[model samples]
Target: MPHMFTISPDFPPNSLAGWYIFNTWFQKNTGLNIHLNLYNSFEEQTIAIDNNKNDIVYVNPVDAVRLVRDKGFLPIARVKNRLDEVVIAVSEENPISMMCGLKPDLKLAMTANPDVNMISMMLLEAVDLNNSNVVKTTYDSYIIVVKNILKGEADAGLFLAKAYDDLSNVVKKQLKILLRSDVEELYHSLLIGPELADRQDEIQTLLVSMTDNPVGKGVLEALDFEGWLKIENEEMEFMIDLIDTLVPDTD
Candidate 1:
């Protein structure tokens, strides 16, 4: 049977097709029959994960930790230098200069990315803020999150740093970044299940050495990656440990 390769639904919409292209490249290069599966919703994906055996995944930090710890997946690589930082922002007119200025009942706009939300919540810890103390309004994307803040429906916005960077200069100037988390180590990763255990080294080498060839360079351009880099087990463990320390499991 062909190996199942899945990507997190949180990837930017523009990059959706890029993953398919990369899958074709991967199959061509690796001479392996890999099937790509992109889920429409996390809930639907969760159901599939519970009943299925996924061979490979490119996922966000939150899921990365989950798969490594619970599903016994092996971290192989991450997009080059792609740390998953969170950006907390407020409207230009709002007077909250620092996170300390935050208080109970402050309205927050955010997307459904749990990793970004978790880190944003950690930033709110500066003022001892938690979901109970703040009001959260979920948006379909970062753009809408900013829209809510600009329109005064939300007092603040939480964003993935790359999404914030992609916003137009005009829109960005109308808001202020109260803070951008700089944990530096949290990032998404490509992982493989035990089914691919024997081929781990082979797959890792192909990913990390993508920049060495023209075909590989073309695929990287489509995916908007500088290149790929190996995810050392030790580094991944520290990130998992940090996540465990930052966010404890609750029933």
Candidate 2:
């Protein structure tokens, strides 16, 4: 049976088609028949990984920690242009200058994902605000979170710095970042499940060497990444620790 490779849908569906092209080239070069599965939500993806239904997965730093610690998945490689920091943004017209400026009954907007929610909570805590005061309005994507704030449906929103940079200039003019989270240099990782342990080295080599091939280079371009880099366990320790500190007793 072919191995299953799944991706978290942190990005748009159109962008994810690059994985199909990469998978084709990967199968040809490595002689490994890997099927591609794209998940629309973090919850679905995590469930699949936990059920041992996926042989390989592309996950963010938070999910990477959970899979590694609880599911026995090994992180092999990471996207070169991974997210590093998140921004707390509000309308330029709003007078909120810092997180402390938020009213006791805060109407916050953020992506409906565990990692982002945790980061938002941590940022709130940093300013000595009770997270319980936050009335969260979840959006499927960062762009929507920004839109919700622009539409006056949300008082503030949290989104990745990169996503904020990618916003249109007109939209940029309307929003101002009140606070920038401390930089946590982290990457979206490619993890190998226990079922694929025997082929870990081979798979890692293929991914790390992808940029060298013409087809792989094209796929990388489509995926908006420079290349993949081999990752060390120690590189993710900070993220794990941050999560633990923010959310106590998280397994």
Task: Put down candidate 2 lDDT per residue, 24-85, tens digits, no spaces.
Answer: 87788778789998776666777887788887788777888888888888878887767656
Stretches off by above 4 angstroms in model 2 are: 12-14, 236-242, 249-251
Q: Could you tell me every candidate's TM-score relative to the true structure?
A: 0.90, 0.87
Q: Model 1 Cα RMSD, Å?
A: 2.1
* Model 1 TM-score (2 dp): 0.90
How far is 130's C-alpha from truth in model 2 (Å)? 2.9
Worst 10 residues of 1 by lDDT: 41-50
lDDT of 1 by residue, 1-251 (tens): 99888887667778887898999999998898999987875555666766665778987887788888888889899998788898999998888888889899989999877788888987887798987889998877788888899999999999888878778899999999889889887888999997777878898999999999998998999899999999888988998988888774641
Best by lDDT, which number? Answer: 1
